[model samples]
Target: MAVLTVNDLCKTFGAGTARSNRVLDHISFDVRGQTFVSVVGPSGCGKSTLLNIISGVETHTSGDVSVTSDEGRPARLGYVFQDPRLLPWRTVRKNMLYVQDKDDDQARRRVSTYLDMVGLGQHGDFFPGQLSGGMQQRVGIARAFAVEPDLLIMDEPFSHLDAITARGLRAQLQDIWAQSRKTVVFVTHDVVEAVELSDRIIVLQPGGRIFEDIPIDLPRPRRQSDPAVATLQAEVLARLEKMKAITPQAATAV
Candidate 1:
């Protein structure tokens, strides 16, 4: 079932001027439930633009963004941003429930379960400022899960964390996704991160073209040092580097 469909997406900045730039051009993709899809591309290749479009945070100049379930129902969305984006004054627990309307027991139960799942049960009352960067991102993850969204969109949520912390969180995220059975679209710049965390990796080029949509068939609990995973990582990064070299500068010009 297609949980999200993006058709003919295009985005341009500063149109009809010297500074104009065509960031994303005619991009399209779809994702199904319980699948983890990661996107990688060179810097300034419009990865964040695509994510913003999917979340309806940014409107495209052309194309359609649709989120429908397996049964064609409207899919509920949860987004975890790169910045964590938690309210500074609110404690972790309160921030998680900021979007909820009722004191319904079900909401409370869901929030509690997610907080524990993210290993923040004991730190629910901690402010965002009091937590480390990784812990703050965990709170962001917990907040997303608290809503029980059908599709979760994460934009490099662990990019700023230490290497060891990022590795641990990647595995934790996989476990959470497995247990929750939610479709996730993750955006990142790290080749190894994409390989270790995604079932399929979509490589975007300078013109917003998908150069590669490689499926990682390696078994679960994939390690960064594993031979097969390492090979895939190298291959993907090489492909990305090659694309950067081959993309015509004219295509990006407005």
Candidate 2:
């Protein structure tokens, strides 16, 4: 069964007014468990708005989003934002544990496991300020996974890292996804990053609607230089450029 469904979603700000803005337009998509889906678009394309709506952080002006298999169960929703957003004073372990109220030994064990999984077990005692940008982001990932979330939402989580670090983390994230099989929705502006990490790529245009949905159909541990990845990235990039060309100059003309 599909884990999440977004049906004919629409969101507008300042409706029926001179200053109104239509952010999302009839967006629809579905996500299954253990699948990595990336949404890519221009800077002001409402990508983050769509993700916020899905996470229940923001409400859509119209249409509906529904999640199956998550009605009464405690679902872990991991969010890796553009910034690590770690607590400055708290040690990595403490910052991670802050989100979990459960005291069961099982819970503690899971926390430790995710810490090690993200390569932060040895640095759990260190403060966020002491770690490198990439390492702090790793801590953020560990904190998110500590809850064992049913869904993971990443909004350009590695945009701040250097290219080498971003590439390495991409591989590590793929490993984590393979091991945990959590439902993942990764939002990125980088086409290569989206191709490397996702099982499917959903391109969002100026509006929140999906412009293209393409399955990767490539083997795991995909390399950036792989012919298939390069070709597919080129294709997606072309689509993005075309989208920009077609978008109207203003809402008045639409």
How far out, in Å, is residue 48 in model 1?
0.7
lDDT of 1 by residue, 45-151 (tens): 78999998888888889889888766555667898988889999998888888855565888888888998998989898889999998889888998887887878
Off by over 4 Å in 1: 70-74, 248-254
Per-candidate clash tally:
0, 1
Residue-by-residue lDDT tens digits, candidate 2, 1-254: 67778999999988899998998999888998778888877666788898999899998899998765656774557788889999998988788888776857877788789889988889988999999999999988877877777788898999999999998888888888778888889998888899888899887776556778888878887878789889988887776667666775322221
Candidate 1 local accuracy as lDDT?
A: 0.83
TM-score of each: 0.90, 0.92
Model 2 vs. true fold: TM: 0.92
Error of model 2, residue 104, in angstroms: 2.6
